[model samples]
Target chain A: MIKAEGLTKRFDDNLAVDGLTLNVERGEVFAFLGPNGAGKTTTVRLLAALIAPTDGRAWVNGYQIGEDNINVRRSVGILTEAPGLYERLDAVQNLTLFAKLCEVDDVAGQVEKYLRLLGLWERRAEPVGGFSKGMKQKLAIARALLHEPPLLFLDEPTAALDPEAARTVRDFIGEIKEAGRTIFLCTHNLDEADRLADRIGVIKQKLIQVDSPANLRHSLYGRRVVIHLASVTEPVRTAVSSLPFVEEMQQMDNALVISLDNPEEQNPILVERIVAAGGAIQFVNELRHSLEDIYFALIEEEDRETQA
Target chain B: MNGAKIGAIVEKEIADARKNRMIILSMALIPTLLVAMVLGTTFVMLNVESVDEASLDEDELSMIPAELSGLNPSHALLILLNDQFMFYFLLIPMMLPVYIAAYSIIGEKETKSLEPLLATPVSTSELLVAKSLAATIPAVVLTWLSFIVLIIGGYLIMPEPVFLAMIRPVWIVSMVLLSPLLALLSVFSGVIISSRMNDPRAAQQVTGIFVVPIIALSLVVLAGKIFLSVWMVFLAATIALAVDCVVLYFAVKLFQRETILTRWT
Candidate 1:
C-alpha cells in the first residue's frame, strides 16, 4: 500500500532520509527499524504527507504525497510518537472531536466501538489526564482507527512506556495486524519488531535492507545447528569436519556448533556418520539469532563500508 | 475549508475551554471583576460629585459643545465620563482574547498535538479560522455581557439622558461592531505569535503588546484630544476589519506545515 522511489528528505544541511526506495504490500506488518535521528520518524512523516519530501516521490494508499496531500491524509491513519491528547478533555469528548474531523458516519457508534475494544469503555467519561500511559496510548490507537483507514502509520507507538504499557501497545498492534490492515511501524525496539513484523526494513537514513525476518537471518548467518554429543573426540571432529555439507564446526566441550546451509536435509546423514565415528547424539536444535544481533551487525557493516 | 470541520474545532475548544482554568480566568473572572469594579467605582464618583458639588468646576461645564447644549449640565458631564469609560470596555474584548489565543496555539506545540490534527483532512485556513473563531466567541460574549451591566448600572444611577448616552450610536457601534473586530484582531495576532513561540507565557507577553496601543488610545480619548463621532467609529471598525485581513494573511503564511513539523520544537 506504500511505494517510494528515491525518497529523500533534507533539512537545510542534514539529510534525514536518503534515497529510500521501498514497497509495502497490502495487509503486511512492515516495521521500520532505525535508531534515534535515523529517519524513522522522518520517513513516517514523509509517507503520511505530514511533511513534504525534499526530492523524489511516494504514493500512500495510491495517493501521491505532495500532489494529493488531503487525499493522502484521508487514506491513512497516523499514531504519532507522542500521545498528544487534550488532557483536560474526557475520553469520549476527545474521540468525538477526531471522529467529526474524520467525518465518520456513525461518530458515536465508532467512538464507542474503539473505546470498548481497547477496554477503555469504563473510563470513557473521565478526563484522559487521569489515565495511565498505557490507557492514553490505547486511546491514541483508538483515535488512529476511528475512521478505519486502510494504511496505519505508527511512529514509535510504545516509546518511553513501562514494560507493561509497552506490552499492551504491542498487543494492540498485533490485534490491528489480525484485522488485515497495512501497518507501517517505525520503532527502535528490535524485540517488538522481531515479534510483530512480517517484514522489517533496517534503515540508516537509507534503505539498507528490506526482507522478511527469516530471510534476513538466513542470509546474514546461514543455518547453524547445535548437536549435543556425549563427548567430543578427534575422530568425531574429523568425521563432522570432513563432510562436504558442513561449512564450519566449533568444538564446545560436548556440543558441536556446526554451520551448514541445509541442516535439515544434511542432519540425518551427518548423524549416521557421527554414529559410525562412535559419538552419542543427545539433542539437536537450530541456533537462533535475535533481531538485535542482525541489526547491529548490519549497522556496523554499513558504517565500515561508509568509512572505507 | 470545510465548515463542519471548522465547527468541530470550535466545538472542541468550547468544551475544552469550559474546563480550562486559564480560559475561565480570562473569559469569566477578569470580566466579572472588571464589570463590578467599573460600576462600583462609577457610583462612588457620582456620590462624591453630589456631595462635593462646590469643589467641582462648574466653569468646565461650559466646555460641553453647543451641539450638546440641550443636555443638562451634570448629565452632559456624565455623558463625557461614560464615553471615556466606554473606551475601556474595548479592553474587555481586546484583553480576553490575548490570553485565549496565546494559550490555544502554543499549548498545542508544548503538548505536541498539532501533528495528528494536521494529519487530518483539515486545511491550514480551516484550522486557523476555527481557532480564531473559538477564541473570539468568549471575548465577544463577555464584552457584550459587561456592556449590558455597564448600561443597566448607568440607567439605575443616572438621569435618563445620561443613561441614553450609554447607548449612543458611536458607543453601540464600537461595542457591537468594533469590539468583535477588535477581538478578532487580538486572536489572529495571538495565533501568529503563539504558534511561533514555545512558551505560552512568552506568547502571551508578546501578544500583550496589542493592549499597549489600546490603552494609549484610551488615554488619548480620556484627554479629549479627539471627539469620537459615529463616522469615526465606523472608520475605526473598517480599519480594524482590514487589519484583521492582513494579520490573517500573515498568520497563514507564517504557519507553514513543514516549518511547524520540522523546525518548531
Candidate 2:
C-alpha cells in the first residue's frame, strides 16, 4: 500500500531523514522503531505528504506523495504524536469536524460510531481539554478512522497511555489489521511494536533496518543452546566448552550459557558431556534474543560504525 | 481547493466561535461601546447649558485646533467627536483581523492542531482564504453597523444642515467599502505575522501597530491640518488592498508544513 525509494529530508545543515526506503503491503502492520530524534516522525510526515521531500519519491495507495498529495491524503488517515486535537471542542465535535472535512456522507453517524467504538461515547460531550492523555489519544484515533481510509499513519499512538488504555489502543490497531487496513506506526515502544508489528523497521540517522522480529532476533545472536544447571562449577563450565560444536561458554549464575554455530545437532553431545563431567543438568533449551535485545544490539553496532 | 471543504472549515470555525460565548459577547460588546460613546458625547455636547470655563484649562484648550476655536461649544464638540469616531472606527477594521487571525493560526499551534489540519486533503489556498474571510467578514459587518449607529446619533444631535450633508456617498463608501478592504489587509497581515512569530500576543501587538497611521490621520483631521479628499482615501484603500495581496502571497509561500513541523516555535 506504500512504497518509497531513497527518501530523504534535509533542514538547512541537518539531515532529518536520509536515503531511507520502505514498503508496506496491504493489511500489514509496519512498526517504525527509533529513538526520539531518529527521523521516524519526519518519515511519517514525508509519507503523509505534509512536507515535500528533498529527494526521491514515495507512493501511497498508488498516489505519488508530493505530486498526487490530495489523492494520497484522501486515501490515508494520520494520527500525529501530540494528538493535535482542538482542546476547546468536545470529542464528538472534533471527530465530526474531521469527518466532514474528509467528506464523509453522514458525519454525525460516523462520529457516533467511532466515538462508541473507542469507548469515548460517555465523554464525547466534555471538552478535550478536560480529557486525560489516553482519552485524547483515543479521540485522535477516532478522528483518523472516521472516513475509514484504507491506510493509517500513527505516531506514538500509545505513548502515554496506562497499561489498560495502551492495550485498548493496541487491540484496536490489531482489529484494523484484521480488517485488512494498512498501518504505518512510528513508535519508540519496543514491546508495543513487538506485539503489533508484522515487520519492524529500526531507523537511525535516516537509514532503516527492516526485518521481521524473529529474523532480527536470529540474526543478532545466531543460534545458541542454553543449559540450566543446578550448579555452575569450574569443571562443569570447562566440560561444556570442550564439546566440539561449543564455540563459547559462560556461567550465568546457576545457568550454563553456551553459544554454538548449530545447536540442533550439538545439543545432545553438550548435554552428555556435561553429565559425564558430573554436572547435574536441570534443563536444556535454545536461546533466542527478544526484540529489545536485537534493537539495542543494532543501535550499538550503528554507534560503533559511526565512531570508527 | 473544493468549496465543500472550505465550507466545512468555515462552518466548524463559526460553531467554535459560537460556543465560546465570551468571544461572541466581546465582539458584540465592542461595537455597542462604540455606539454608546459616540451618542453619549454628542448628547452631552448638544444639551449642556453652560460651559465650565475651568474645565477648559490652557492645556486642554490648546489641544483643540485653532480653526475650530470660533465655533460654539456644540459645533466644536461635534468636530472633536467626529475625529474620535473616525479614530475609534479605524480600530474596528483591526479588531477581528488581529483577534481572529492570531487565534486561528497561533491558537492552532498552541493546541498542536495545526499539523493535523494541514495534513488533511484541504488545499493551502482554501485554508488561507477561509480563515481570511472568517476574520474579515465579521469585522466589516461590525464596522458598518457601528457607522450606521453613529450616523443616527449624529442626525439626532447635530443641526439639520450638518446632519444631511454628513451622509454623503463618499462617506458611506469609505465606511462600507474601504473598511472591509482594510480589514482584509489587517487579517492577512496578522495571519502572516502569527505564522512566523508563533507568539499570538506578539503577533497581535505587531499587527496592531498598523493602526497607528490611521490614528494619526484622525488626529490630523481633528487638528484641521488636513482634510482627506475622497480621491486620497480611495488611493489609500487601493494601496492597502494591493498590500493585502502581496502579504497573502508570502503567507502562502512561508506556510510550508515542513517549516512548521521542524521549527520548535
Candidate 3:
C-alpha cells in the first residue's frame, strides 16, 4: 500500500512533482500514466524512498518514506527504467548478491526461486552482459521480487522490449497482481495499463484523474451502444433516433452507434422498437471508450489548462 | 551499519573484480611488475662494478645516510639504492588504490548498476564503507606482498647484513602502518572524486593528480633530501591517519544519495 499527501519534489527551479496526493490500496494494481518529463519517474523515486520528498510526506508499506526509509526500502521492490543490473555478473550471482543484501534467509534458495520463476534459470551461469534487453529486464524484475516484498514500484516495466517480450512482462505483472501484491506501475504504455491496472492515475506534474479503467472511460464519454444491422435502412435509423432515451446517434456503415442518457433503463425499449420496425438486427453491444482516447483527452486537457 | 550488508557488497566487488580482466591485471600484475622493475634495475646498477673498500672518496661516502656510512662503497650504494626504492613501495599503496577505488563507484554508475544497489536496504555509510574496504584491502595486501618480494630479492643480490638492516624498524613500520593509511587515503579520496564525477577516466585522472604530492614525497626521499627513519615513518603514518580521517569525514558529507542519483548523470 502507498499513501501520499501534498508530495512535492523540486530540483532548484524546476518542479518535478507538485502537491500530488494519492493512495493505492493493498492488492491493487495502480498504473501511473504520463508522458516524458511529466514527473512519473520522480514520483516513483519519492515513493520508493530513493529520494526524499522536498515537502509533504509519504508512507510506503506502512512506513514513513523519509523517517523509516530503511524499513520502507526493505518492504518494497523497485524496478527502475533501466534494468540497472551488474552486466558483468551472471544472473545467479546478481540475484544472490541482492538476496544477501536484503538479508534473506536461505539466500541461495531465494535466488534460485526467482531466477527459475523469471525463466532465467537456464542462463543462470551466463553473464548478464550477454543477455538480450528483454532478458535483462526480466532478470531485473526477478531481482526486485527476490525477497518477495509486499509492494512493488515498477518504472516503465516494458519500455524497450519487443511486442512479445512486452506481453510477457505484462502477463507477469498481472500474475503479480493476482498474487495479492500492491503494484505502483509507471508506464507510457496505456494499453497495458488498461488491461492490467485495477485503477489508473493520469498525471501531469500533479494528479489529473484516478479511477478504474471503466469508470474513467464512462466519465469521459457516456455509455455508447452500437446496433449492427444487415443494412443501414431509414426505418432502423429513424426508429432508433426517435427513442426518448437516445441522446445522439450516428450511422457508420451498417451500424447505428447511439449514446443514451441512461442505457440501463432505456436499452430494452430501443431494442423492441428496432425489432418491431422489421429491422434485421445482426448484433447489439455497448461501445466502450478505448484507454487511448481517455489518455489523450486527459493529457490534452491538462496541457490546455496549463497553457491557460 | 549492518556488517552483513557491507560484507555482501565487498564480497560482490571481489567477485566482480575476479571476472574483470582489467581489475585482475591491475591488482596482480602491476605490483609484481613494479617490484621486479625497481629491484631488478637496482640490483643491476649496484652490482655493475664492484669497488674496493679503501678507494672511495669522503664526499661520496658522506652522500650515504649516516646509518649506512660504515659499509664499503658497493655495499653502501646497494643500501642507499634499496632505501631510495622504499619510496617506490609507497607508490604501490598510493597509486594502486586510486585506480581501484576510482573505477569501483563510477564504473557501477556507468554500467547503470548503482541505482538498484542504492535502492536496497543498505545504507549509504554501509555502501561507502564496503567500497572503501574493498579497494583498500587488496591494495594493502599487494603492497605487503610486493614488499616481501622486494626484501627476498634484495637478500639474494645484496650483502646479507645490509639487506637485513634495510628491513629494520623503519621499513617494518612503514609497510605495516604508513602503507595502509596511505592506501586508505587514496581509496577514500578516489571514492569521493568518483562519486562526484560521471566519467571514471576523469575521476581517475583527478585522483591521480591529487596524489602527486605523496609521490613527490617519495621522490624527495629518493633525492636524499628527506631522511626516513622509524620515527619519521611513525610521524608520516600519524599525519596520514589524520588526513584520512578528514578525507573520510568530507567524503561522507559529500556523498548524498539524492544528489548522486539525480545530479551526476
Candidate 1, lDDT over the whole model: 0.86
Candidate 3: which stretches are off by over 4 Å?
A: B52-59
**Candidate 1 runs further than 4 Å off:** B49-73
> Per-residue alpha-carbon lDDT of model 2 for A142-244, expressed as tens digits?
8899989999999999988899888888899989888999999988888889988999999885564798887787777777777888888788878877776
Better of 1 and 3 by DockQ: 3
Q: Could you give the DockQ of candidate 1?
A: 0.84
DockQ for every prediction shown = 0.84, 0.64, 0.86
Instruction: Provide the global lDDT of candidate 3 against the true structure.
Output: 0.85
Q: Candidate 2 versus the native: TM-score?
A: 0.89
Please provide, for model 3 over A160-242, each residue's C-alpha lDDT reduced to its tens digit, 9 standing for 90 to 100. 99998998888899899999999999988888898889999999999999999999988999899999988888887788878
* TM-score of model 1 (CA atoms): 0.96
CAPRI-style grade of the A/B interface in model 3? high
lDDT per residue as tens, model 2, B112-216 = 888888778888788888888878877888888888887888877776544643565546667876788789878888877887787767887898777888888
**Between candidates 1 and 2, the TM-score winner:** 1
Q: Could you tell me which residue pairs clash in candidate 3?
A: none
Clash tally for model 1: 0
User: lDDT, candidate 1, residue A68?
Assistant: 96
Sort order, DockQ high to low: 3, 1, 2
- Residue A116 local lDDT, model 1: 97
What TM-score, over all chains together, does every model reach?
0.96, 0.89, 0.96
True-structure RMSD for candidate 3: 1.8
